[model samples]
Target: MIARKFWVLALGILMIGFSSSVTAEVPEIGQKAPDFRLSTPDGHPVRLSEFTAKGTVVLVVLRGFPGYQCPYCQKQVHDFLLNGDKFAAAGAEVLLVYPGPPADLDQHAKEFLAKQNPLPANVHLVVDPDYAFTNQYGLRWDAPHETAYPSTFLIDGQGAVFFRKVSREHGDRTTAADVLGELERDKAAHAH
Candidate 1:
């Protein structure tokens, strides 16, 4: 019995270690943001590095079509849209990541955007097929009936992450006002 218990504990430990090793860590402030290319609904490829090359990038990972459209995600997107002018003035490009299975992903993205007004020129919605981008950024929720964890990252022109917020729950999301304030602070800090 003692030997059997020891083997079970060892197997459990090994499994835990393996799982932790596979999970990616969230990019910290001052770390270079991971570059990824995902397609817009109309098939244009959007690359993170390209956006960062021009100016600041607000990378938002939304809970996309997880059996149903997430209301919180909609509200968050709407909030950002309401602040479109401010974001544009700050020279920040908002990249909204809608992630799900490859099948019907674009259709779902369209459905999600249907309720909102047309996206501002500064905002771009990209699809993450089969959670590739989510896993790459360590934001995959990996639970039944769940999608990627809602996250927001602020990357400066240099491609370095200056701010980030990852929400484990659906409702607690970073607000547009919060991000705009961060942008102002970041700009002031850089000036000095």
Candidate 2:
């Protein structure tokens, strides 16, 4: 009986360690944001480092074609579109990441864009093929009818994360105003 108990304890500990190692943590504030290279629907490669090299980057991960277009994602994109000028005026590049299965992902992203106004020049919509970028950023939803957890991160010119928000559900996503506020705060902080 003592040997059996010892085996059970060992198994439990092993399981705990394995699970912890498998889960990826979101990059914390001040941590270097993970650099990624994803493509726009038109096949242009958008590299995170290139954007960070110039100015602040607002990275937004969206649910893409989880069997159907996500209304919440649409709303969030619309909100950002409304404030496009503000984001550009702040010298920030807004990168919208649409993650889904690789199959026909580009068509779905195009359809999603069809429903919205022409994206501002400073705002670019990039596709995350097969959830590669999502998984790298630890935002994959990994469930039925889900592509990725809605997430937003503010990375400065040096690639340091200044703000982050990951929403488990459909709503509760970070807004343009929220990111703009963070940019102002970061700028002021660095001015000193």
lDDT: which candidate is best? 1
Which parts of model 1 are misplaced by more than 4 Å?
1-21
TM-scores of all predicted structures: 0.88, 0.87
Error of 1 at 84 (Å): 0.5
Best by TM-score: 1
Q: How far off is residue 136 in model 1, in Å?
A: 0.6
lDDT of 1: 0.93
Q: Which ten residues in a row have the lowest lDDT in candidate 2?
A: 19-28
- Model 1 worst lDDT run, 10 consecutive residues: 110-119
lDDT of 1 at 123: 96
lDDT of each: 0.93, 0.91
What CA root-mean-square deviation does each model show from the true structure?
A: 5.4, 5.3
Please give the distance, in angstroms, between residue 77's alpha carbon in candidate 1 and its true position after superposition: 0.2
**TM-score for candidate 1, residues paired by index:** 0.88
